[model samples]
Target: MRHFNHLLQRLRKIVAVALLSATTAALAGIAPAHADWLKAESERFIVYSDGNEGKLREFVQELEGFDRLLRLRMGLTVEEAPPRKLPIYLVGSRRGLLQVSPDLAENIAGFYMATDEDIFGIALRDQTVNTLKHEYAHHFMMQNFAYPYPGWFVEGFAEYYATVEIEKSRILVGKYNQNRAYWLQAASWMPMTELLSKRPLQTARNRDSYYPLAWLLTHWFVGDPDRQKLLSAYLRDVGEGGDPVEAMQRATGLSPTELSRTLRRYMRGPMPYQIMTLSFPQPPVTVTRLPRSANDLLLLNQRLKVGVPDDRRPATAEEVRRAAARHPDDPLALLALGHAELHFGDAAAAEAPLQRLLAMEPDHVEALQYLVRARMEAARDAESPEEAERLENEARALLHRAYRADDANYATLLLIAENRAGGAGSPNDNDVTVLEQAFTLAPQLGSARINLAQVLMFKDRNAEAIALLEPLVNDPHRPSSGAREMLLRAKGMSEAEADAEEAEILRQGEAEDEADGEEPPTGN
Candidate 1:
């Protein structure tokens, strides 16, 4: 959760708030009231659904099957445990997806939010699953292969896997994503040069064809035996520092124009998919029905977790308050209410519920976290130095308590790193160690990585800083001027030169981002 997002905002007042990525969502806000709740807990997932119990159980098994399919193909053992149990909220139906994201973009069915230590997704259970799988594929890549894969293959690979068909005893993969069928035939396709070039094409509306086309190209390479080898070779060359377009030509011996024609012909023909017998059966699952009293708060908790746009926050926050009041003694309810309060920019208001939660469960990890955030924020606004220091000390103690309860929690480690290093002096070795540990726990978390890189740079460990910033700079989803600046420092550039380079990168990325409706990538 990267400090559950809300805590990070509090840190923004003290330190630089340079997140690695920020993608716009179709969702605007939420109004909460949930009943008929069921939870399906597996080793790698905790899914909440308000659908039929039998159907929900089957969905859980299918998801486990998909995880196995991914691992098996990637040369990993199927039985190994995942890093953490991902929480998924499979809302009831298509109407439910829209319920969460009323202004959802055309064809988008779901979304996922990832922090360094945790990730969660919201989608409609009994509806189109292509986008759900697509989002999970992105998560899988970020967790395992956070490599500097070319921008096209990043989307292409996920698109290729998005249509996976999970069955009881087997799985089907590489199927053409029918979700894009409408666009493939009717939408305006991008130029061959635009498709093949490493630079992102600058057009938001025209990007509609991007998904289907990327899927087609990936499918083409995967279906042909020789082309598959060529694709692997293309990846190898890119990994070894070849230009993506040039590497494509070197590996396949085809011009972009010729390749585009070949793809157009290929698109008109039947698609290809591979069927494999499942070597891994479904994992065990525990199902639980949430208490009736906790119903409304349950959904409210999920809505807050996903977030609400500022324009809609007040309304959603009020709903959260009302829901918690209905269950004053409920710790989970208090936690959600506290989260809503923090996000609504009323840290003081968050205290009551959080205090209630702590009084009941003194060691409640999340409650301790909310209190830390609230107190620090209060300190930030204190009337005098004495009050500020007192509040800060109290916040620090709560942070330590949170660590003792779950030391491995990335959020706690991150909070510890911030508290230790936020002052005038440079961070000591303990601070560096804590930041490094947080990075290890959530390599995909942008802030922790950036914080650790800064510490290393401060210590003149430029090589370590460079290695850490490389993937971040190369990740398309994570366009950070801070990362580029750090990379420049790590590479021994002058301060003036780094600043100049960062400005140039931002100028370029902003243009592409505006046109393509995506978070800009780190630029050279």
Candidate 2:
């Protein structure tokens, strides 16, 4: 059951990538290119290039520096590095890049694919560093923060970090992006209401202004002392499921019209460099070579291309299995095989390779997570109840271990809460606590909200359940039928009864106000 939840996250990523591919295809008017690729591994990234090792190595160094700068600026203090290495595909030429992603070739220098394990990117060699910095800014934020921020903020923050400049001994942050500044100067700005809305900008023209405007707003928020507290308050309110417009109004004491006017004036003014300089320690570069064979490259390419609309994952899985068989001790091959089997084949097929990978690298979070799922699946098919119970216990123990490994993981917390709620017995109080924490961590997660609502309904806390369900009832992406049903059940009342309930609550409030010697008269 936990495995299914894990798989859903992976599938969501895949679907997102597929949609991005489709959007890019529509915009570019070109198709995806298939080509032979080579792989280079760094401490933080796996560089897949069309045989551009030198430039790829430079790109990796730039990425490492940018990563360090981001950590310093964001105040993240991780004792160990991330468990998984990000994959960066460096296309040798513009033509090569177009073949891979026409949309990126047309509109942007590069793009990032937020897959399950790898934070993937594809770029031409000329603009590798710039493109990587932009995409990696997005990756860094998503990796560090559990809650979903406004789309505008996400892009704006990325644009803010994307202009990092690395020199001989110093790294520069918050450097003005000339390209974005130009865009802001040339284009008409979006209304603050539309710009700050949760919905993404659909048109390319809107997007052109969106990035620059986002940068400007984020810059002002961070740079202006007057707005810093407001920004913090806005983030907190939004994280707690408050309406974005209301949150903004409450925090800033300004309406949308006023904000737009102020923002326009700010943009028209002379923009400063706004640079923050810090000493950067040059780390020694280390490179690992991935298995470079026709089959190995093919399998890897397939794995990287899994989210594309025409992705042939079954063939990729077979290729991965063959690659793993050929290079039996290759951790990459094993990991790919395990993931492919888990997604495409049954858990039984996935378990052996994942187990082998785990043996080689115990702290591999993805492997640990997948293996837990595989074990649970095997337990479900166990010959006897005792065997099934033993496997279930083992799966639960692994889940706890996974949580211990990364308590900040919202998915792990959600999974624990889900498993606890779905147990044969009544849901536990601890489960409710975990669900609440998960909800706090990722307020945008509709499934988490729905599940928490279900738990609240079971506990007969209908008002709380109603509060949770109301926002999600209209969510198109998620199945909201259950939520709608629960809403109806929780707030079950005739029209007259609802009116009476409202009147009674208002009367009680008015009576209390009168008792405190406060005037309660109000106009409708």
Clashes of each: 0, 1
Worst 10 residues of 1 by lDDT: 20-29
C-alpha lDDT of residue 86 in model 2: 72
Query: Which segments of model 1 are wrong by more than 4 Å?
Result: 1-35, 93-103, 115-118, 196-199, 203-205, 424-432, 456-524
Q: For each candidate, what is the lDDT?
A: 0.72, 0.65
| Pairs with steric clashes in candidate 2 | 33-99
Report the lDDT of model 1 for residue 164.
Answer: 89
Instruction: List model 2 lDDT by residue over 218-301, tens digit each.
Output: 887876667878898998887676766668889988776666566767777765554555555545555544443433543353
Full-model lDDT, candidate 1:
0.72
lDDT of 1 by residue, 199-240 (tens): 344332346666677778889998777888899899888766
Q: Could you give the C-alpha RMSD of every candidate to the true structure, in order shown?
A: 15.8, 17.3
TM-score of each: 0.79, 0.59
Q: What would you estimate as the lDDT of candidate 2?
A: 0.65
